[model samples]
Target chain A: MIAKEKFRVCPDTGFKVFDTTEKLIKINAVVAVVFLAVGGLFGLLVALTRWPAVHLLPADLFYLVLTAHGADVLLFWIVFFEVAVLYFAGSVLLNVRLAAPRWAWAAFILMLVGAVMANVAVLQGESSVMFTSYVPMRVAPHFYLGLILFAVGALVAMFVFFGTLVIAKEEKTYEGSVPLVTFGAIVAAIIAVYTIASGAIILIPTLLWSLDLVADIDSVMYKLVWWGMGHSSQQINMATQVSIWYCIAAMVLGAKPLSEKVSRGAFLLYIVFLQLASAHHLLVEPGISSEWKVFNTSYALYLAVLGSMIHGMSIPGAVECAQRRRGFNEGMFGWLRKAPWGNPAFSGMALSVVLFGILGGITGVVLGAEQLNIIMHNTLYVPGHFHGTVVAGTTLAFMAITYLVVPLIFRREIIWPKVAQWQPYLFGLGVTGISLFMMGAGTLGVSRRHWDMAFTDAPLNFDVPPAAFLMMGLNGISAVIASIGGIMFILVIVGTILFGKKRGEDACRTNPVILPGGGATVMAAGSEGTLKLPGTIALVSVFFAAFVLYYFVNWKYLSEVWPLS
Target chain B: MTEHLNSGDGKSGDSNGGPENGEQRIHAMQSLLDNPFLLLFIGVAVPTVLYTVWGVMEVVQVPIGQ
Candidate 1:
């Protein structure tokens, strides 16, 4: 039986006996990091194999490893960490315990089981469906079973988060409104529910087909629903990463935004528009109606980009506001000089935002354009663009959060604080270097996911300048360096866990000098208490109008084109 | 050190005492039911059972990707 002491709670102080929620968050973070590292290694292997000069790994091994890497790192690691962040948002940020701790653990177990089964099946060569897991290229039944189980676990976690929010409201733990971070998390969780549900619809049918229990499933239908999961999940990633930016900025620099109202409003905008932006992926795919694709990709996606721009400006605006308060009289860019650069968390966030804006933003918008996409589709540019946003933006934010969370939750001093300082720089430089190289290669027309271009009739010419191959080789080398940097990060975390000093008497010191007034300052100063009912109503009305307009326009065109078959 | 850390001193500045704390404790207890572990179990189990049952019911035998 679980000990009563383990389950004990102090209501007056709002502390749990075991601090299970905090423990679970740390565990999930570590697990996700491990998977991420494995994924990175796999990625490096694939890049090396593809490089013209150094074809290190064999062809079959290359595809298999790439599939595993995408599934484990991109899908599993990011989602699991997001769930961990969801729990942190619910319990810690909102100052409410989980609605169901037992159920939360159950979800973790299910995800673990599912992840294990999927990984084993993939490694054992029973499945090689790629990360997309497109039908026709089938895997064993267990692979699909594992994927389904993982999705279900994710869905349950989402429900628990929403349920916790409702209870927090009912109990009146905090007055007026949910915290901004928690609010963002709720929006992300809602997106997750839709994404995972769509994934379930696609994967479950395919799983049956793999087992010889179903004769055939329509490939077109599978691709359609699969993107629902694929694209929606990326939206969730975007929302959660943006929210983390806020949290990390706040914690690291004692920074508050110029206007909490604007920041929170931006989050709400993401909830309404982000999923629609996913149509950008389907733009180049065949079988989808041109009218539907055009509307979804161009108009809807532009609105999503508008939301991203709002967030993009707000982070700097918040920093500028904070700096102005500190009496920094420098011009627009001078405020950047006043910003804290020594603090690893602050620097990491600052660099990530800049990289994400210039590299990720420019490339992404260009790729999303219908005409430009026709040229760049399925090319090295696609991965380069995504890596800029995901690895440089989202992963870097997660790394920065580790600096804050490890100290606060685990009560462990970080090991080699100076070495920890260089991690963001090394990793960021490597990623940027690799992405630029790939972008250059893409400009010269290099295709993605190909094993050997030399064997094909239309082989990539080594004769004529060799610039593309040279760029690709540089990208591979950068990946190796980036992998080393990632390893250094893991070592720091492990060392902190094992060898760092534990917070003894200091654990009871509730107030830190950094955050002078603690929770009260945030609650009172921020927009939580302000009820901008008019603004909220206006926002909702705009969303509804946009939805109706998009629906009618697309419906009219689609009807004319297809004529209901 | 462990004993000293665990021991409750009268001078220790913990505000709420015994029975009142118990009431708050009960409220907190009620919240844990929606924990991720329990949700995860239900999420995985329900889907697994449903999918397995569906597969069993369908008796088609064609090679994959035909």
Candidate 2:
């Protein structure tokens, strides 16, 4: 097979690039962007409708747009990119030919068909059950079928990832452990396997019920099993994005993990504890044991938080250490201040780390508390929290990596480099505003799924505070800004891929500012490999202080909600 | 300069840069698999044990009928 196969070593990065893997990665990434465009458009409509002033869509259209938005952005776009990431991490990183290239194509087609089918079903106005599609709502059969096909296809692609790993091992691609990026990807794939299996367990039955083949479905049972797939999919994102963080840090700064064993231990903790977050959704629901809820939400889930905390510390610690080694050591913050912020890759990733750790991580800990969930569980705050994690964290990280992928993988110079430099900041600011304002409105008790925040059309009108209305209006404005930023991203990625000038091999053959020797290896700076990380320690202290303050604030709010004293 | 190294450690660099011989490739992979941390069982086994014990204790400690 080795003698028979023909592949090229990327001159810029020195990774073995298989023709099929290249085709697969390119196609998946392009399609993922297409979904992002569609989803972002739907999201703008959703924002306008939620604004009391705008109220853009009627109730029916609002739910439909919301459904499409969730499906496209959360499920379709992210997973398609993830499939590409799996292939990149597996075949390219391991320097092995992809196993079962033909099957990989089949998986891609199935996913594309499923995604389009689900979207079409939503547009038809019969499947506007939102992404959860909770039981007894009774969506069209094709809606469930579309999701099932998509899950199965994704599962097949995951298997292809596994097969590629085995092929790499059998072919002796690398030594010691797999690279940490590949290691994190493996964690994602493992979690994805369980998630998709959970989907099959619940969804297959629900599909039967939808078709009237089965009589009835239990709502609680459905939610329990559904979240195993639903929320865990986000867990997959968490792990994958963390992996990309490591990759970006290494690529841009030639950084290494603070400690391989500790980092690996954190990843292992994710494998054990991350999916327990699904229980957060079920905390306030009845009939589930308090013991189960308490354990899942508090003790075990905190371990998962610990995993995230480790990555948060180590990723920046690695960067600071590497930067200092390169003589950027004027002050505690000089290394960070002197970082390559002009590079969209570095800026996007850096913002993603800060926003995710501060906004997502803190809010997540608050929500995961069994008692504290009562006030905010069904409010707009839930989506606000996720926006912090998914959009600000994962999507931004993915967008950051796309900057590198365009040049390295597609062999094109980035078009409009100046615009690319500012794109992440604009996007980050808008998304941050959206998250904050929505959470503020939710604190005043804005319903998550209600189309009109004003209750203008409700049978019995209720007064939502003036501040809530103001926050909704601000959310509308923020959405417009974010939409512009998103458009800029799509334009840059699409324009560059299609029309950007071909990068000469000589120009890419060496990356002197980052990697040495034309990207011959993932250069990890700092020969000593010690954790003299005062900067990271200070940062972590600040994070903990914020976390503690927010935790107590939420508890105080919870107490005020009950006036039982 | 004789052989290019991939993303692993120094000593285990492929002798000829490419996968020239089956035995050499197998040897490299075996060394990776033999490492305690890399093996899947060693990686996840302890966490699984800890979670199980923690779960049981929480279940026992929960006040019944609350």
Q: Quick one: best TM-score, which candidate?
A: 2
Instruction: Put down candidate 2 lDDT per residue, A142-218, tens digits, no spaces.
Output: 99999999999999998899888888877788654677788788888877876787788788999999999999887
Task: Please tell me which predicted candidate would have the highest lDDT against the true structure.
Answer: 2
Among incorrect, acceptable, medium and high, the docking class of model 1 is: incorrect
TM-score of 2: 0.90
Give every collision pair in model 2: none
RMSD of every candidate to native, in Å, equals 10.8, 5.4
DockQ metric, candidate 1: 0.03
lDDT of 1 by residue, A1-565 (tens): 4233243342212233247677778777877888887888888888888777998888788878878887887778888889889988887666666767777888888888888788888898868667888888888789889889999988888887877777676667655345556766876887787679878988888988988988987665676667777777877888888878777665544555445555655665555555654556656655555655565566656766777776776666656655555677565445567666766777778778877766676677667666556665777877787778888888887787777667666667788887788888888898887788887777566776767634456544533237888888899888887787788788888789878877453443542313432333332225222222232344335544654564355345435544564
Error of 2 at A311 (Å): 0.3
**Cα deviation of A275 in candidate 1 (Å)?**
1.4
lDDT, residue A148, model 1: 91
